[model samples]
Target: MYMVLVRTRVLPGDLLHDSYTGIAPPNTYKLGNKLFSLKVGLVEIDGKDVKLIPLAGPYIPRVNDFVIGKIIDFDAFSWDVDINSIYTAHLPAQDVFGREFSSQTHSLTSQFKVGDMLAAKIIAFDRTKDPVLTVREHGLGKIVHGEPIKLSPSKIPRLIGKKGSMAKIIETKTKTKLIIGQNGIIVVQGPSEGIVLAARAIHLIEEKAHMPSLTNMINELLTKEV
Candidate 1:
C-alpha cells in the first residue's frame, strides 16, 4: 500500500480521521464515527492506516540501544550521564577498566572528566533503576571533537529519514559526517561550513517534522546559498 503525506500539526483532541478511513492507531481516541488525536503530534495516513508521529517527547532507553550522552558528574565507581532522558544513566568504571576495576588504582578523572561527551550503548535499564551505559563496544567512545546539537527525541526518525535517506542526503551535500544518538543528541564533524549547514538542516527537520514535504524542504535549505 502507498502512503499519503500530511503537513498539519496536531494537538490533543484534534480531529484525525473517520472510522471508515480505518481506525487511528494508538494515542488517538474514537468519538462515534470519528477519530481524534490524544497526543501532541503530526498525522500520517499510510494507506488506510492513520497514526500520529509525536513532535515532542523524552527518550526512553531500551537495552542495546546506542545513545549519545554527556558526562555530567562522576564518582569513583561510575559517571553520571545525561542521555536526554528524565533519568540519568551511569557508566561504570568497570566497563572502561574491565571487571577487575580499582577505584583507587584507576582514576576515573584520567579517563573521562565531567563535561566530556561519549557515545554509548544502553546495557541495562528498567523502571526500578536508571539506565546503565557502556562504551566498550566498537564505534562507542569519547567524542573528542565535533559540533554537538540537540533535537526533539521524537523527531530523530525524521532526521534520519526513511532508511537513512535523509541523513545520507545531508552528509553527501554538506560533506559532513553525523553520529546520531537515539537520545536526540547529534555530533556533526567536518568543515566548519558543512557543520553549520548540516546543523541548520537538522533543526529544520525538527521544526517541520509534521510537514509532508519535509525532505524537499531540507534539500532546498541545504542547497541554498549560505
Candidate 2:
C-alpha cells in the first residue's frame, strides 16, 4: 500500500498523498509535472538510502567527462588538461580551439603559446575518444593577468554551491571578480585587500561545503574585516 505522488518524483516516504491520484497494489506509478522517476536502484536521502524511489535532479559530469583542451606546448597543436575525471583530456592544435585551417593559414602554434591557458566549454564526447571543446565566445580565452590558486577540481560543486549562492555571496561581500576553472584553477581579482579576502572565502567554502550552515558560516567569516 505504498503510494508515491504522480508529480512529486518522491522516492518512498516523501509525503506524496497530495501530488498523486489512485491507490497502489504496490504498483509503479507515472511521474507527473515537475517530477521524474528516481529509477536508480537506491540513493542516500537525508544520509541514508533505505528505500528505492524516484527523485528530481539533473545530470552533471562525474568521475570522467571527456573534455576538449587547448595546446600550451608552443610547437604542438595538442596539450593535456584534467577534465574533472580520471582520464586526461587532449586538445590537438587543430582541435585545440576547433577549426580546420588551410596549411597556409596561421599555424596553431602561433595562435597559442606556452604558458597560455584556454577556457573551453564541453560540446560532445565519446569516452573511448577524446572529448570535443569550443571556446568561441567572449568569456573564453587565455587568462592574461590575475593570481591563480589551485583547488580540488571535485570540490567545484561546493565552491559554486546550490543556485550559485555561494559564489554570489563571496563576490558581493568582497567586491571581487572570480573565474573558476573546471580544471581546479581559480582566478580572483580586485583591490589587493579584496582579492585576498575572496581567495580566503573560496578556500573556506571548499573546506566547508558539507557543513549544514554554510551560508551563515561564510557570512560571519566575510564580515570580520580581514
Candidate 3:
C-alpha cells in the first residue's frame, strides 16, 4: 500500500492512487487505471485501499452506531430524539424500559422528560425511513451528569485514536470518563477541573484530527494538564 502524508489536502478528482496500487474506497471513485478523490479532505490509505476522510459533512445515521440524543417530543409509545442529524431518531418505549407500553399503567413522559439526554444505539435506519434507536444495551441509558461537547462527526475516529489509545490517555491524565457518541456528542465526567481539561482535550483532537503526530501532541497536552 502507498502511504500518503497525513493532512494532505485531496481535492475532488485528485489522483489518489493508480488502480494497480489500491482499490478505491469511500469518498473516492476509480476511472480506468486511476483512483480519484470524490471529496475535499485528507487522504487515508488502509492496506490496499484508498479513501478520503471528509473534513465536513452531515451525520448519516447507521445501524449500531452509539449516539447521544436529546428527547424532543413524545407520543403514546415512542419518543422523538434529536440525534444531531437531519433525521430525528425514534426510541420506542419497549426499547427503553424493556416492556410494552400500557396506557393504563405506563407514562412515557414520567420516564423521559423533554430535553433529557441519553446515550443510545441506532437499531435500524434506511433512507426511506427514520432511524430507530434503543437504550437497551448495557452501558446505554440516561446521561445523568456531565458537560456535552460537540465535534465534527468525521473527527470521531481520530478522537478515539487507534484502539482507543488517545481516549484512554485523556481519561487517565484528566481523571475523567469520556462517553463518546459517534453522532458527535461527548460527555465528560469527573471533578470540575478534570472535566474541563478533558473537554479541552477533546476539542483539541477535533481541531487537529488531520495533523500528523496528533496523538503525541494530545498526550503532551494531557501531561501538562496534570
Return the top candidate by lDDT: 1
Q: What is the C-alpha lDDT profile of model 3 across 102-158, one tens digit per residue?
A: 856788888899999999999999999999999887999889999899989988888
Q: After superposition, how far is residue 7 of candidate 2 from its true place, in Å?
A: 23
- Give the alpha-carbon lDDT of every model: 0.88, 0.55, 0.86
Q: Which prediction has more favorable TM-score, 1 or 2?
A: 1
Worst lDDT 10-window in candidate 3: 16-25
The predictions' CA RMSDs to the true structure, in order, are 3.7, 8.5, 2.6
lDDT of 2 by residue, 79-184 (tens): 5544444455555556544566444665765656656656666555565765655555557656666667666655565677789888888888998877876656
Which pairs of residues clash in candidate 2, taking residues 3 or more apart in a chain or in different chains? 6-32, 38-54, 77-92, 77-93
Sum up the clashes in candidate 2: 4
Q: After superposition, how far is residue 98 of candidate 2 from its true place, in Å?
A: 7.3
Point out where model 2 deviates above 4 Å.
1-43, 46-71, 74-85, 92-100
Collision count for each candidate, in order: 0, 4, 0
Better of 1 and 2 by lDDT: 1
Structural similarity to truth (TM-score) of each candidate? 0.84, 0.62, 0.89
Candidate 2 vs candidate 3: which has greater TM-score?
3
Query: In TM-score terms, which candidate is top?
Result: 3
Model 1 global lDDT (CA atoms, 0 to 1) = 0.88
